[model samples]
Target: MRPGVSLRTKIYGLVITIAVIAFACSLWLSIDNTRTYLNEQMQSHAQDTATSLGLSISPYMDGNSPMVVETMVAAIFDSGYYLSMVLTDADGRELLTLENPVEIDGVPAWFIRYFPIQAPTQLTDINNGWQMTGQLAVTSNPGSSHDKLWRNARNNGYLSVFIGGVALALAHLILSSVLLPLHQLEQQAMAVTHKQFATITPLPSTRELNTVTQAMNSMVTNLQTSFTQMAMHAEKLSSDAFIDPLTKLGNRRAFENQFIAQVGEMQDNDLATLGLIQLPSLQVINAKLGYEAGNGYIRQASEVISQALAHRTSGTLYRTGGSCFFFKVASAGATVEELCNHLHEQFSALYSSHYSEGFANIIATSYDNKQQLNPLVSQLDNLLTRESSTTGTGLVYWAPEQESQLQHANGLHQWGEIIDDLLASNQVTFMFQPVLACEGNQTSENVLYFELFSQFLQDGIPLANSELYAMAELLNKSLELDKMLLQQLLTIGDFKRDVTVALNITHQTVHSAEFGEWLEEFYQHNASNLPTLVLEISETAILASIDSSIRFIQQVKACGIQVCIERFGSSFTSFKYLRGLDVDYLKIDGSYISDLDENPGNTHVIQAASQVGHGVGVKVLATHVENETSLRLLEELACDGVQGNFIQPTKKLAPYSEKKQCQYWPI
Candidate 1:
């Protein structure tokens, strides 16, 4: 049979086994000791009783009756020590008999069976005179001994249970205390594996556990630092791979990625519009003014284009090539013609006045249908070639009829081939627009304000600024353009007087540490001769690189240069950023100022902006003031200055006193 076992049963069995073995040895020893002592007492009691009875019976045998012997025996039995007593004659026949009984208390039969103790009886023979006449016998009761044995056994069993329980409780408490730290360590390891990097502040109680925790913390800290560094390096590499180093604008690779994504989205959603603009005379301009001016034009154009597209809630602009650019727009069901007209008006007005003679030849092509981009691009090429044959005047949209001509023009890739030649020649030129002060207390202190502008030279003639910038962006030479423009401005020595000349700074240039270092060197060389220069930055550019822009501004300020925020209100909610930047001027966007008199909304906006600017200690300059009325309104609103067609056209740099002496319009 399988061994019978249960927790209680096993415990009982073990206890019983141990107890039985112990009790057997103990009982044997105790019983031997008890037997020896009890026997001696019993023998002594028997001898005493027998001797007394014999002495009394001897009198009876000599002269008394049998009753007298019986009385003596009864007296001895009544003493309670003997179980039985007998008196006999010389022939050993019973003469008198007596019996003794004893009662046991406080003991069970089981106790007695578990630990039975017995004492042997003793017998003695007595003789009258010389012969044995009778036998005397005495027996002792063991009730007291049995009761004592039972009580001792029960006490031992209880003691055994108490000792086992105490041992179990102590064992459990010790085990838990020893293993608790290991459990905590396991949890911390899991957290680190999941990138939590949580610290273990509570040290383990044991020295070995504390050592392990310290080692883990050190390893995790190192790994976390390394991982962060690796991630930053990877991000830098990825950005470099897809960005144009010069323009800091998205390059052809970036354009392609965006183009594919937009096209796929448009195809799936059927809600987007695509537009492309190609600057036809970029090469000619780059050739005339040098690559630096060419790059300046591109940077300027990119900023303007980006600003224009941003006005539309959901549109993105991309520099696709040296002379080509792309845009994606969510039309919100607006007609292509309406969009095109709006773009045409904005581009024409902005570029014509700044670029002079070169504005007339630039072209913009747009495609709105999701299924017609390829055909549209082809048609645009044809239109460009046809226009080139003629005067290259105004904008053109692709029509179905141009398909045949597009096929013919497909073989001509002249635009790309001329770029290198154009860059090799110094064909770019810089221009300036005067930002006239509108305040009534005007003094001829030669405090003339001007904004930087650029153009591309074509066939010894200038190309429009927009066209040049678009081309530079496409060629991935925006930084080069900016550098060239700055060089040309310095070469012209227009900033010799105590005037403020504002130059546009791109986010790409501002973010580049190398560019910053180069700028420091340039300023060091021109420190004594430099005018009170003001660097103008767009809100969009600032938002894109807030930290770098702030750092650049600080560096420029350290060089004694002023910083202004251009197109300030274009980013409607970006005014909050002004609190963090140290800016001297806020140039209000022309869009909000164009119809200020007619549009209460526009007037309210300008008024509110003026208050905000003055509140923050920044001077406000209103742009695109077209007539006497707008100028008067700007002055009424306490605008610090104004710049527009209505203001005096920018003249060649003259002595500081002479330029400030002439007032184009009397306020």
Candidate 2:
């Protein structure tokens, strides 16, 4: 638990400690044996000299020849082994004595003191002719023993160091090789904590380590797969939460959700346009021709309204009432006069041809951004009352005084302030709704991915994705807005505890090179995130430039991002786009999803679209699913996923920054 210590260092220290202990024991034994050997040898040498001199002196004593004895003692003493020799007569008189000072050069005094070799002495008595002789004593020199002992220790010291050095080197090499795989596993595990998955290649020689490595690799792979599946399911569950079921348009809840999202970008100079199309006699027709016939007419009219508004800069068609359809238009350039013209002609045709006795009239008005919605709705209602009293068939009315006050998103300068404020503050959040799969478990807990709608917070109100994105497209700032949203999302790196994110890209970004480059850089910087980032584009834009979109989407995919086309099948040319473009998910247009089980026409197209999507390995998901019946029908048609109000509603969630990162490390 100590700081700044690693496993390798501990191993190294342990090995060196054991080596030091073993060598010290060996050195002590070596020095002890050498000292003992030298001491015995010295003793033996002294004894030999004393015995030799004693016998020679005995003969000298018997003859009473001291000179001879002295001469013999001197001869023996000259040898380096003997340090001193002494011989005497029988009466204890000294007959002969030889002494020599001994010094062993090149041996330090400290070495001798620390590694002392004691000199040995031996004694003998000389006796001749029954008379007692003097004793002869010899001393052996120990300097030679000390020198030998020093040489032996020096050699042993060098050998011990050499052996220890080589041992440490070999130990380090083997230890490093063994621990390398473990280190890689640790790195891989850390990356996974951040929701990134990477494979490791380790071929260990040891059986246990090799097994551990293989197990770690398999664990990482499984974690990655599970995370991907979770992300997809959560995305489906989230998308189904808000989308309306009947008209294939955002229901009242979805509209309010979008409206709240757009409120943030509302400025004093901004305009909010609301228009209603009323069919008063539709209820009468329903009573006479039956509810089935009435419902068919409403469905047909809803489709036409959505189609008409599809080509416009930005608008959402909503079924607000039993016999009414409305449009929510917010722009700075001009009113949706073109859309009204298309409406008048279509309604005029139905009326002039006498398609039915039901009369339809369109009324539109624009209000300054500061006005509240209640007053606007009231004003529109008063206008409809006038229509009910004065006109019967096809009629178009505009608020006489407010038409001139309309403004469109005409210039960058006009929107520069609002956009800049959003960018600077990053005052935006995404509302996520669950998109459930029809054929699978429909629990929100099991969903892994959620579809996101970006809302920018302005003046204490959040602007919905529709308005924020629509205006961005109108001002040609769609690419910039996309980049900004991406940056913001990256800041919220974690989602659903290791989930993949499906982000919707506006049309301008899908076609812009600038956005492409920005996306590439963003992915590269966030590669560690292994975000499982999925980019979604609408079929409306992809159909226009299938080839270019295919190329751009491929480029993004090459950067390790997933691509999908939202609102698929807007054109029957689904075959054309599906043929050339590579996509992962095809979100079937909501209209086809509404009452899919009941409408044979919608079912036929759904089946065909699902087949084509599956043929290309793309998943087909029906959005705006409202009832269990429609969900069951889509499942029967082989829908990969289903998202709508029937599954779950859109909900706000805790921001990613506040959540904990996933931890999947093995204990």
Q: Model 1 Cα displacement at 354 (Å)?
A: 48
List model 1 lDDT by residue over 1-667, tens digit each.
2244534445546655765676566656655565456556766767777766665566457435777877777876786667777666666677777776666778876765655555435555555577555666666666655555555555655665565456545744654564566656666665554234555677777788789978887876765555445434433543454456555665665555444433432212133445666554456668887778767767766776677665443456667668676666543222333455666666566564335333322233433225545575566566756765656554444333322322112111333333344466656654456787755633122334777555556577544333233334434455665666566656566454466677887545666677667778888897666566788887767877777887877787767778888866543442445544667888986655655555434555566677666645678888777677777778878888888656755443444555564454111
- lDDT agreement of model 1 with the native: 0.59
Best candidate (score: lDDT): 2
**Candidate 1 TM-score over all chains jointly:** 0.39
Model 1 off-target regions past 4 Å?
Answer: 1-424, 440-448, 494-496, 650-667
Candidate 2 lDDT, 207-321, residue by residue in tens? 8888887888898787655545543443333234433455666555445434433343344445556777777667777888888877777887887777777765457776765
Task: Report the Cα RMSD per candidate.
Answer: 28.6, 14.7
Runs in model 2 with CA error above 4 Å? 1-311, 315-334, 337-413, 437-448, 572-574, 597-601, 655-667
